[model samples]
Target: MDVQSGLPRCSRHPDVETGIRCTRCEQPVCPSCMIPASVGFQCPDCVRGGSGTGHAPGANQPRTLVGGRLRTDGRAVTKVLMAVNLALFLAVHTAGDRLVDRLDLIGHAYYPVLGEVVGVAEGEWYRLFTSMFLHQDLVHFLFNMMGLWVIGGIVEPELGRGRFAALSLLSGLSGSALVYLLAPPNQPSLGASGMVYGLLGAWAVLARYRRSDMRPVVVFLGLNLLITFTRPDISWEAHVGGLVAGVLLTAAMVYAPRARRELVQYGACALVLLSVLGMVLVRTAVLL
Candidate 1:
């Protein structure tokens, strides 16, 4: 109760008046303290308490903001991803351009070693995924790995390991699809830029959802966009595609109806992949 106005105050915020009560503890919670749960809005304390500490086994467990299970090692998935990218970079350095040509994202190109035309249009669809881990040089590899370390570390805990991995791959694939559809058939592209940009977009969305200051993210994104367009070497298509996909995917995860959250989130991911496949097929047909 508030001594000033004689009205009930939120447990978390003494100055804020609120009539809404948490579904679990029956404690009054202000709008800022309310978190959407499977049944109804709950306070942060109740959500944290339900994390399998003293609660009975099989009791309705708490979920993350995006419906993922809470984890202690939030950056576990990020480390693995970075390792994969680093391993692939080493392999490319050892094997040289032949390996790069074989693994890089290309629409269609003639390889002298094979003495024939090959590319995604010729059914090398795996390139779309493999190319994500390839990099041009030491600088490129370091830059992308650092980004994964930071952004993936932030997003993985919130979305869980599986969901975060799925988002990264799908976002990269979206970028590859755009490059395939728009770039010259013989042109080649590779890097984790798409995936990094995707994670960046997800970070922005998360910040917005939490009602945090948006200026920092907005300014950073703007700077990146400026660099993407100004630099001749950058693949704007990949950056733009990944950014768009990340925004949409994160939105679906965070804003889905609490009644069927997992279904809606994973379903959105599937739809994005299907859309990418459709784009690939159409582009392949045109190339062929």
Candidate 2:
């Protein structure tokens, strides 16, 4: 009896045929060789590649499942991020002042008592996360979300959701932190611009790390930075901080040892988050 037809033989284990394809590399794998992951099955080789998969020779191997679902073979995460931003924009507009006020209360607001941190100086510190969900106005929201839609669509599918999420959260927090540290005492800031900038930075780094042509990223980043500095109402602090942090964090993750890169990336993000929190605390103390 040919077992290969009944159960796909594990590419790694000749004796074992579990009929499972690695969600990452799509290599036939046995249950014993299959490694369970947050998104889906990942073989040992794919797991070891980490963010460096695109650079690996065989990394392009077809994926059977991703994030525990049948592969759509499209930029699902990018589409979702864009949809969320658009939906939130409509909600904020439709809800009007009521939504803004509510978001201000729970979202990141300029609070002298809380200083520059997202939720740290105030009980609503959760705003660090929530603020990313809110936008200052329609134009502001649309522009930032559009950037995310474009850059995220390009990067998320390549980097995967976990890395993309980390980039978004860290960039958002970093942007907030910059505003907290550098903005006027009573000034308040909110938007997804910081995260968008972070995505730009990440893509720039990814291009270099993967040795891909970076002309597009460089052109885009340069144009945005120019706009950021020239625009009077723009939160330049958030843009600068998030961009810098994104670059640094991406560098740390890209250059670090593969076995330890994820840990380092998480640690780097945590440190930035804490730094933002600390800035808020100091500001609160100074005001008090």
Candidate 3:
């Protein structure tokens, strides 16, 4: 505020005095910098980052996946997810030989915490999530962790922690649903393969939407899916389910309108979960 002029000088244009403050940032602005918005006047900086802005400028964008991840800060969430996978793998081995079977998706096992052990025949439900964390062997654990290390490192920074976590978990659950629907009732399925595929799907969708070269990602995913089907012991159902979940969830995250991104993403996540739940209900009814 200028004592003599009876006006406030703009923060950016200090020489100019203004009678109004910006509605958004509430900073004094000269009329030139004051941009008219839906509610009120906003500064140029806010307008650039807000809904007024359209597609990101591709001229300055990176052309490589490595560039995309490294462009942001360190991927702490990726490291955390990897560490958790390692810890769960170790814990599964230490606990007991049968623990993996119990943790793996059974579509029928339900053991109450600190209570009696529940069997698939008893309608156990925790396996859907626990199975995602549990691994059958060191080889299985290493391969999945490798996928997480690579994919999570790439996706987490772009989507942030919450969105990535949601994608991973939903992908896992969708995999479980597929296994439940396709595999024999007594068969147990376990691994983070579904979530890994989900990350792949997410990366692919994001790259395609952003107009980046998606060939590398697509080829990698295709090769893995090939192996998934040819391998006798592999659960192809989990892979397909996870890939679909990842693509759908990531689409929701990336394609959401700028004005309602988080809201739309969370809603999409809920819709995915509900669809998974519906699958489980249909399977359970058939099993009963």
Model 2 CA lDDT for position 159? 58
Best by lDDT: 1
- Model 1 — which ten-residue stretch has the worst lDDT? 52-61
What candidate 1 gets wrong by more than 4 Å, as runs, is 1-62
Per-candidate TM-scores read 0.82, 0.68, 0.72
Q: Report the error of model 3 at residue 36, Å.
A: 23
Candidate 3 error regions (>4 Å) = 1-73, 109-121
CA shift of 249, model 3, Å: 0.8
CA lDDT scores, all candidates in order: 0.85, 0.68, 0.75
Off by over 4 Å in 2: 1-74, 105-120
| Residue-wise C-alpha lDDT for candidate 3, range 17-86, written one tens digit per residue | 9987554445667899888864457667656653333223432222222122223444676677778778
lDDT of 1 at 128: 91
lDDT (10s digit) by residue, model 2, range 22-132: 766667768787789755577777777634333345553433211212334446666666677677677877877555444541323454444454433455556555566
Better of 2 and 3 by lDDT: 3
